[model samples]
Target chain A: MLETHDTKLTEDSVRQLVREEIQRAFKKDPAKKQACIISSKGTLDWAYPPLILATAAAATGMDVSVFFTFYGLNVIHKDFERKLKVSPVGNPGMPMPVPMPDIVSSLPGMTSMATTMMKSKFANKHVASIRELLDVARESEVKLIACQMTMDVFGYTQDDFIDGVEFGGAAAFLSEARKSHLTLFI
Target chain B: MPDIKEDVVLDARNLLCPMPVVKAGKQIRTLEDGQILKILATDRGSIADFPAWADDTGNELLEWHEEDGTFVFFVRKVEEED
Candidate 1:
């Protein structure tokens, strides 16, 4: 009888331990994970960082929001494909088959050529296109927010953006950023 | 190394950072609890990304190995309790 009573106590303790372990495993709330990013550049090369980071963060199950301000608004603009261009004139770091001086790079059609080369190079490298990244960001529910003040300054309307974009001002971005542990201005 | 039988195979070969993890995250959601996913990727960055991703999502990173130039990863899904 004593042995049976001791066994019952052991079983109860074991069950309690298992229950505690399960609770400990769930201590970190998934909903609390958040990331906020600000995209302030509109160049083709500049566009990738914010979108990539946002999508990756969303994929990791973190709530993500990206604020588009200044020229960055071009990323969410309907004509993003055409508006986003790479200018080699001022960017000497750009690799070229034949190096050209700033004067030559500033010549007509140079930006178009640089942009095309970058697009093809990225394509060859299997890098996701801006459009594809944007699609993934949208599908993953990453919030794309356009700054209302910048929109007004740039004379852009709500209809100028693609679907699923939210419009807000600095305070809106700050409110979200304050709650996020990871905040970046890219 | 013992072979792990995976319930799903995700071919992310030649894809860059974020795509592999992005695709893996998408695929893992389609699996039931305890199901294993096999991912093949060429991006070197995934060597660090996968483990962190698994930790963040509360999934299990069963094992990872480099076969030739390809990085192979096996992950098991862990259901979140609300």
Candidate 2:
């Protein structure tokens, strides 16, 4: 096939390309405005994802909702400061800043120690704390929905959760999730 | 490059990832269409974060540069029509 160099390099064509680039840059779809998250894990480390993502999404003007199920209820529980702690004993491959025997990780109060260390590390890195993220979620009006089935199974009353936390079931979560363009499970 | 004059300037220095973006989102709302906002952030991540945020919000990221270890971003408000 013979090459044809018929296309001329016009200044207006170049300007049109730049204009299209800016227009494309400013295009935001309506679907990306909504986000739904399922927080099904209760570990201290696991808690970060849902809260961090929801708050960040909400900050970006997305209508964000988080549904907490099963053990994830601890995140919205009033006593999360005491109830939420990470244990390193069961996981042999858990990363620790220092090399330590598994025996040390299994000792009593080690979970709390690990939690304290993780909290400090996050603080030093200027990352928002779980509580601070929750506050941001609330301030940003991110919907925090607690699973009703889990509440009933665990015998937790509505008062067990913090203020502004809504009660909902799987159906309710799905209803919100379906409308959201971004759905995540953490 | 010519200095792009801004209508509003936000100092988001020393803030983390989402904080800067969140603050910028809120600030941009107060601006009218075609208005430009200048954000000064210390977080290196804002280099990418601002453009991503501007794209998500239907705003214009005119230009961004680094000065004295600070990431300065100029974002023009472009309201998304319903």
Number of the top-ranking candidate, with lDDT as the measure:
1
Question: Individual DockQ of the candidates?
Answer: 0.72, 0.50
lDDT of 1 by residue, A1-186 (tens): 346546567777778777987867656643358999999999999999999999999999999999999999999999999999999987979998898999999999999999999999999999999999999999999999999998998899999998999999899999998887899999
TM-score of 1: 0.88
lDDT of 2 by residue, A52-120 (tens): 788778867799999999999999999988878888888667678887687988888888888888888
Candidate 2: deviation at residue A34, Å? 1.4
Q: What is the lDDT for A186 in model 2?
A: 82
Per-residue lDDT of candidate 2, residues B1-82 (tens digit): 4489999999999778677887787788899999999999998888888888887777889999998999889998997786
Clashing pairs in 2: none
In model 2, the runs with Cα more than 4 Å from the true position are A1-30, A92-94
